[model samples]
Target: MRYRALLAFLAAIVAGLMVVSLLVGPAGVGPVAGIAALVDGKGALGLVMREIRLPRALLGAMVGGALGVSGAAMQGFLRNPLAEPGLIGISSSSALGAVIALQSGFAAVSVLALPGAALAGAVVAVALILMLAGPRGPSLTLILAGVAISALAGSFTSLVLNLSPNPFAVTEIVFWMLGSLSDRSMQHVAMAAPFMAVGALLLAPLGRGLDALTLGEDAAEAMGVRLTRLRLMLVLGTAALVGSAVAVAGAIGFVGLVVPHILRPFVGARPSRLLAASALGGAAMLLSADIAVRIIAPERDLKLGVLTAIIGAPFFLHLIWRTRGQIA
Candidate 1:
């Protein structure tokens, strides 16, 4: 009952935030004007609201929701609540791919190019991890592989920036890594929506498997879950969702790691319930962050990712401190 109510409240809040994102800009547009323009058409306020802020707001919700659900699924699959897209290097690889494409000057022709390369990079990282883990390797091996991939991708990104001729490329790369929803457009939405959709579809059904996984691989296998196939589905889905998010939005952290855990209690630790609840919570968190990013600057918009880091970093540190003993 609470879960359903909370979701409803979040939906209402998201709707309100969308309204605020549309109107609460430095341009002095109000919701009334924005909506009027949207409905009536042929107004400057309407166009800017429709073209700029609306797409960004929607993308923030979409990407944030995908990350949240993906994170929950990962944590379930790994039996580790701390697992996140970044920890496994998917985001880094995605960012590297985006950087390569952007630096190649394809981004100049179309912003969508980077996202494609990022997806490619994400798939590569997942493939490498799977190959390293093999069919029967332990979970720990897969984690180690992910860590190595992250380090490699990060170093390669730095090296690429250093080698790039365009001075602007370095700054751009840094900002992109920081994560931001600012200035995002329909092109980015187009690049990411299909992938994110696919990810959601993959993950929503894994709730039962997640429950089985909490009892360990052998236990899950005993419960009729095919361990290898389940793991493959999780890895591939997470890669597609997260890869596309990084491709479109860069590396927005904490949404995955934070949302599920925060809402775990509300849903009573059931992985399936947590999945849907966190999806809503994550959407709210990101959309709210987008609102914050726009209003806080109103003029000098910071990246949505930056704000999330500022907010998530402390939470993350506390989590690390809390879990250090456990991980060790």
Candidate 2:
């Protein structure tokens, strides 16, 4: 009952935020007219609501939900509360791929080049992680390998930016690395939606496996929770989710890391329940953050990633302080 109530509450918050998100843009559409325009699809108001704010709101929700769920799944699989989607290097690698595409001038040829390169980078990163950590390796091993991969990927991304001939391209790298949802179109929604949907399908059913794994690997295996399959699903699903998200919005941080941490206590720390909760919470947090960026700096182009980092980094320090004993 509590779980249901919590989920319902989060859902309500997300819904409210989505409505606000759609209505809060510079178009000056009221709640009633904005919603009406969404369905009516006739006038300039309709076009702005449907085309501009709608895609931004939808992508914000999707990206936030993906990051949140992926973070929960990662934490559950590793049995570490600190585990997040980026901990596996997938986000960095995807960013690297997008950076490369942007730098190489291929992105000019096709709209698909950026995201395609990002997805490819995610795949390669996953392959490398699996190779370095081994299929059956422990969580610490995976984390260490992921850190190395993330560092390497970050370096390559920096190199790409440094080597770009277009001075403007160097400036664009901040948007790619920090993430933003500005000027996003329905085409981006179309490109990323399928991958995000598929990844959600893969991750949603793993609650039982994560719960079992909480009892330890041997216990989980004895209980018939195929560790190999679970691991594969986690890697691939996270890759798909994070890859698609970074491809579309760049590398918005903290939603994945912070949302789960905030919602975990409410869900009794069950990975599966936490997944759903985090999804909603993440959506709310990001929508709120997006709204904040626009409100706080309507004139300056504030990066979504920058705002999240400001909020998350302090929280991260607090988290570390709380867990210092464990780390030591």
Task: Specify the highest-lDDT model's number.
Answer: 2
Tens digit per residue, CA lDDT, model 1, 1-328: 8878977887787777767766766777666777888676677776777778778878888888888888888887788877886667799998998888878777676666777888899989988888887766777887888899999999999899989999888788788787888778888888788888888887878889889888888888999988777777778888888998888888898899998878776788888788888888888888888888877886675888889989988987887687689568
Give lDDT per model, in order: 0.82, 0.88
Model 1 local distance difference test score: 0.82
Q: How much is 64 displaced in model 1, in angstroms?
A: 0.7
In the range 48-153, model 2's lDDT, one tens digit per residue, is 9888999999998999999999999999999887688999999999999988888877778787888888888998999999999888867778899999999999
TM-score of each: 0.93, 0.94
Model 1 residue runs over 4 Å out of place are 317-328
Q: What is the C-alpha RMSD of each candidate to the true structure, in Å?
A: 2.3, 1.9
